[model samples]
Target: MFEQFTQDARQTVVLAQSAARRLGHHYIGTEHLLLGLLSQPHTLAARLLVVRGLDLAYAETTVLRLLGTPGLDARDADALGTIGIDLSAIKEKVEATFGRGALDRDPAHTRAGRFAGGGHIPFTKRAKKVLELSLREALRLKHKHIADGHLLLGLLREGEGLAAKVLAEAGIDFAQLRADLDRDIPAVPA
Candidate 1:
């Protein structure tokens, strides 16, 4: 799936991962992807988003505010466990720095994303779905490969995700955004 992504698009994903890591998030989410798109000034997606008044700082502020202070949720802990990570050690480390009961007091707030950096961060379910839908959008448009614009389309189509909500709150209409893209950005044939 990654092989078909354009160079800029691929870079956007890396930027997304970095954004998630920088935010201390243990999982990559659509909000991270939004940051990724906004990070690259040269991509069509970035241009489009910026034209609509979206930028990295605004996106970061909105996403962080929306997500709230998250701790390790059960599903995320289970996911980590499946990958052979010992949650107890992680909790101990967190507690050592932030003091006791830090990891458990709000254990259900997995979105807190404080365990980022070092080692691989996994994609959240919605993040994976966004990537899949990005590819699908590219294919549906008969494009040879997925690009940042396709990623924007995927975020729009996945309307229930945080990124979509943020976009909506920022006054972006997905349908019009798609229409504008179709009008301005030509999809290259395979």
Candidate 2:
């Protein structure tokens, strides 16, 4: 399936892995893929996303805010907040005492999924589905290869991943974004 990916599409996948690592996440999810798309500022996906206020920095912050650092979850914070416990403040003090990344869970201690070896983070099922949908999107559009735009289309179509959540948070209209992409996708075959 990757054989049909254009260089830009391949780069997006690589960037997704980088995003996951940078976020201290053990698995590559749709949120990381969305950050990957935004990282490539020159790509059609990035351009469109930026126009809608979903730049890489904003996306990265949103992903971290929602997903939290490794070993932590945003929901945990919310739960703590309800109980008058400030997780963020506690984390800050803990990290200050033990150095940064002290709260991060060791990979070996976490559930082992499909590790790609050499510290390669595995993709979440939904992320893999996004890639598959990218192929389907290319075929649907009568294109020969998958491109970054197709990846974005796939993310939007998936609609249940964290990437979609970020889009929703930004108030981006899925149908309008897809229509805009469809209007512009033909100009670039890759």
Candidate 3:
């Protein structure tokens, strides 16, 4: 199935893995795949998302907040605030003590190094489903290869992944995006 993916699609998957690692996640999820799509600025999917104000950083922060990453969520901030603890101050102190982005770094992965010796970060079930659905979207569109747009279509069609949730929270109209994507997909000559 991956063999039918275009270079951009394959790169999206690779970038998804990187997103997972960067977020200190043990597995690649639909949210990571969404970040992957946003990372490729020139892709049709990225362009559409950016037009909707869904940039990579915002998506990444949303993913982390939704997944309940340590010290990254608003709820965590509120809780700390109640206790008279400033999360931002803590973050600043940590960064001052340990260099920038100390909180973002995964110590285990950092010791082993990026993309190295981390064993392998497997995809979550929903993420695998999105990939499968990407193929289905390509077939539905009568395309020979799955591209990044197809991947985004799959995320939309899945409708319940974290990516979908982020899109919803970002006020994206899924139906409209789906229509635009269906129209924008590059056609192959018969």
Candidate 4:
């Protein structure tokens, strides 16, 4: 599958991991993939996103806000709120007991064996799905090679991940973007 990836597409995948690590995230999610694509200026994905008003700085800020410092997902906190758990109180107690940076270590580092190492950041299930779907999208388009736009297409179709959520929060028109991507990029001629 990787063999079918264009150079920029391959770089996007590599950069996704770096993006996750830079953001102190334990897993590489679809949001990181979006960041990865945005980080590089040379790809078709980057060009289209920029032209459509997807600002990298703004996107990064939104992601970080949504993520909210390592160890706590804003969604999880909201969910816990429904049960009156008081995550903020818990956080205060934990910090008081263990001092700062107590839960700072990324969970990826604590996983056994293949995921045990500090430097190894694995893709979340959804991110992995995006890559798989990218291949499927390229094949469906009758293209032998996968490109960045195909990856972006996969990201859109995945639909339920953080990437999609972030895109929505940033006011990106996913339906229109998808249509533009599907129409503007042509499959390689057979």
User: Best lDDT goes to which candidate?
Assistant: 3
RMSD of each: 9.7, 4.3, 3.6, 6.2
Model 1: clashing residue pairs? 24-113, 70-109, 70-112, 71-109, 71-110
Candidate 3 lDDT over 103-146, as tens digits, reads 77667766876433355788999999999999999999989999
lDDT of 4 by residue, 1-190 (tens): 8888888888898888777665646678999999989988877788888887786787788886776666568798999999999887887787577543335544545454333334668789999999999988888888888889999999999989888887888778999998888886667621
Residue pairs clashing, model 4? none
Superposition TM-score, candidate 1 onto the true structure: 0.74
Candidates' lDDT values, in order? 0.79, 0.83, 0.87, 0.80
What's the lDDT for residue 48 in model 3? 98
lDDT ranking, high to low? 3, 2, 4, 1
Structure candidate 2, residue pairs in collision: none
Q: Taking the tens digit of each residue's C-alpha lDDT, what string does model 2 give over 1-190?
A: 9998888889999999877765556688999889889989999999999999888888877876776576557788898899999998988898687544446746463445333233678799999999999988988988888889999999999999999999999889999999988778763554
Window of ten residues with lowest summed lDDT in model 3: 110-119
Error of 2 at 73 (Å): 8.3
Clashing pairs in 3: none
| Error of model 3, residue 48, in angstroms | 0.8
Q: Which stretch of 10 consecutive residues in model 1 shows the poorest summed lDDT?
A: 104-113
Cα-based lDDT at residue 114, candidate 3: 49
TM-score (all chains, Cα) for each model: 0.74, 0.80, 0.80, 0.75
lDDT, candidate 1, 1-190, per-residue tens: 9999888888888998888766656678999998999999887888888889888889999987787646656688788999999776887798688654454333334445344334566788998899999988887888888888888888888888889988988899788899876665557622
